[model samples]
Target chain A: MLAKPGLLVLGLALGLSTLLPSEAEAHRRWLLPSSTVLAGESDLVTVDAAASNGLFLFDHRPMALDSLVITGPDGAPVDPTILGAGAYRSMFDVPLRAQGTYRIALVSDGVMGSYELNGERHRFRGSGDALPAGATNISSSRSNSRTETFVTLGAPTDTALQPTGSGLEMIPVTHPNDIVAGEPAVMCFLLDGQPAADLEVEFVAGGTRYRDEPGIVMLRTDAEGRVTLQPSEAGMYYLEVSSSQDAANGQPGRRASYTAVLEFLPL
Target chain B: MRVSIAFAFAATGLAAAPSAAQEMAISVEIPRLKVAEYHRPYVAVWIEDAAGKSVRTLDVWYDVDLKPEDGAKWLPDMRTWWRRAGRSMTMPANGVTAPTKAPGTHSRTYRQGSRPLANLPAGSYNLQVEAAREVGGRELVTVPFQWPPKALTSASARGKSELGAVRLTTKR
Candidate 1:
């Protein structure tokens, strides 16, 4: 759940960080896979990473791939091939050498705050150690975010879907690759390995540029931190959640955000 | 007297198989569509109870001869059947899985005491046939009927796109 008071403080702190432009909040980030499920002795799937105002259009700047992580079914990191970043999107190809699921994610963590140096206020966005020396009145908050998507080679497996217990994450109750339109899919949110209750989630289907309405669905997680999504149509959809936690016991305020790109097949 | 009659019948070596008492026949029609690329559609035929739970999967027509046996990859294209029963069972199931059929009407029959219908309880059930084609659309047709038929019964349904006329008949 989002702490209201913490959000106000975090909002002010975020405003002080000139490094994070307003476009960062308006733009949506996603990872789109060429295919979620595959079969054969060996199959390859291409992926696109981008951030855009129009859902999945890739009209805005390319999402950074510096923190990209690809975990194979065997719980080992797999290197992606044909990795390249263009003006609008970053691209990569992953070979499904083993049969099971693969998780592709981009994880980033940083701090945003302001400090006073010789009576002048300065803003920064990076690790706390990166702050200037002899700084005073340091007000900072930690931010962690993850963007992810899943692909399966043969049979869908759950090993790759396990949460790392580091930041905000989603564990799919319904196999991500098996989602179908008109059927309900359950997903549970966890914050640092615990259920994140009462958090608001935004669900938006792709093809926003053509539709008359954006068709955004607002959902809230239950006490158990689960949300059941029933998409009426088949297409690529994006889910996003962001929340702020108040500072407690001398700890700095914290913000966590999660985003995922999911594809729903027609029934 | 009844014992004597039974003895006489046994002496004559006259006996009927239990399965001969009841039978079910189904006909599925895959329509020919004029399109740029045409491939035989993967089809699934099964029975479901009133609660929509699958009772039996009678037939599954897919590409069983693909190299490396990767043909099952597209099984999910038949989304309805895949979700209901296909995913639960292994592919190439004996007597149930078959090669995809070309555009035409195909028929099959199942006896009451056979592999699939042997233990089906007497109740209201639906005969569902679904077809999904690559680079094409999908269609499903259903026919409702009762098991352990009171008398000769027949029903048929038509599909608009991928499938044509589907008929089901039962006898007891």
Candidate 2:
């Protein structure tokens, strides 16, 4: 039963890509926190969210915080305050009252497609059932994407790192807050609660505006859906993994992508 | 029999301990930069083993005078020290936390058989000093030295911005 929906979503993603070529190539969405690790009494972390062509730069449109999720160390949802969306990016603050890690993510699941009506092709984004009534050559796809980062107040904990078993997710084999340069860190990717094997993961160091090359390190997941990353330098990094399944059994093609902003410190 | 044997070994170990006190003196220089907005940089000084595990945190210089909660908000700006040891420690650590200093040279001394260095094992260690400035840049300088110094040893490194010259001297 679980495999059935996976096949259907893959089909839908393929169909949607063919209908709307521009949407096939998605912009990079990210949530960059001011500090990934903190220690103090009553600390607050500010985060910036955006979908941009430049890594960590806010040249593109703002990422909406409507679907933003903040899971505190106790496995309970925490509300973010001082929320505001500007022209280029959205921002918010999460206070660290607890003594453990916090998971901050912007999760969105939507169906996007296009159809031909009276020989005019019209693009549609939203629910599958919201399509026009009398459209022909209808094609649609379902997309599930998550952009997230982690912040820890004191000692890091795993309660907030647990996977939701929905969409595409990454479970850190090495604690995200504990990543260090020159040491290999492992990350496991899961597609809808199962190991996502053979997926290509892109790791790019931040500060792209000053560099001529993007310096992207392309790595593939192992049979266990894990990737070992050894960052040479210590700084902020952006990681992205995406997968698309071909249309199967007349179902819409499905696409799922995950991105995270990680900070690696020098040993 | 076991208790008597353990006590005998402990007594012998204490008797074999070095009579002269060993100490390390660290000098950190925060360089003055010509910039529009110049805020004093937050600095962290510590010692690490060859494998990069933090052995001791000598000092942390941040906005310690600000409201308790407000100052620590920027502690992570000193990213290297924050990740290595700061994240695991409570803020305003007694005798270790101090206010950020103006652009100049500062010196501190840590003696063996003290709070932080009391339990340190003999090994090759790196004295790391990291400085981070708001609306500016960040830099780190490292000076390596060996414990139970064979002689009066001294080493230093220079940073272009945020930090100046960082020197470490060990005395037996």
The reply for model 1, stretches above 4 Å from the true place, is: A1-25, A37-42, A72-79, A97-101, A112-114, A120-133, A152-157, A246-249, B1-21, B116-118
By summed lDDT, the worst window of 10 consecutive residues in model 2 chain A runs over A16-25
DockQ of each: 0.27, 0.43
Clashes of 1: 0
User: How do all models score by TM-score?
Assistant: 0.82, 0.73
**What is the Cα-based lDDT of residue B141 in candidate 1?**
92
Model 1 DockQ vs. reference: 0.27
Task: Give lDDT per model, in order.
Answer: 0.83, 0.83
TM-score of chain B of each: 0.88, 0.87
| Candidate 2, residue A16: lDDT | 40
Per-residue accuracy of model 2 over A25-61 as CA lDDT, tens digit each: 3567789999887877767899998877788798866
Where model 2 places Cα greater than 4 Å from the true spot, the runs are A1-25, A56-60, A82-88, A109-143, A180-184, A204-217, A230-237, A246-254, A264-267, B1-20, B27-40, B101-107, B135-137, B151-169
For model 1, how does the per-residue alpha-carbon lDDT over B30-75 read when each residue is reduced to its tens digit?
9888999999999999999989998899999999888764788788
- What CAPRI class is candidate 2? acceptable
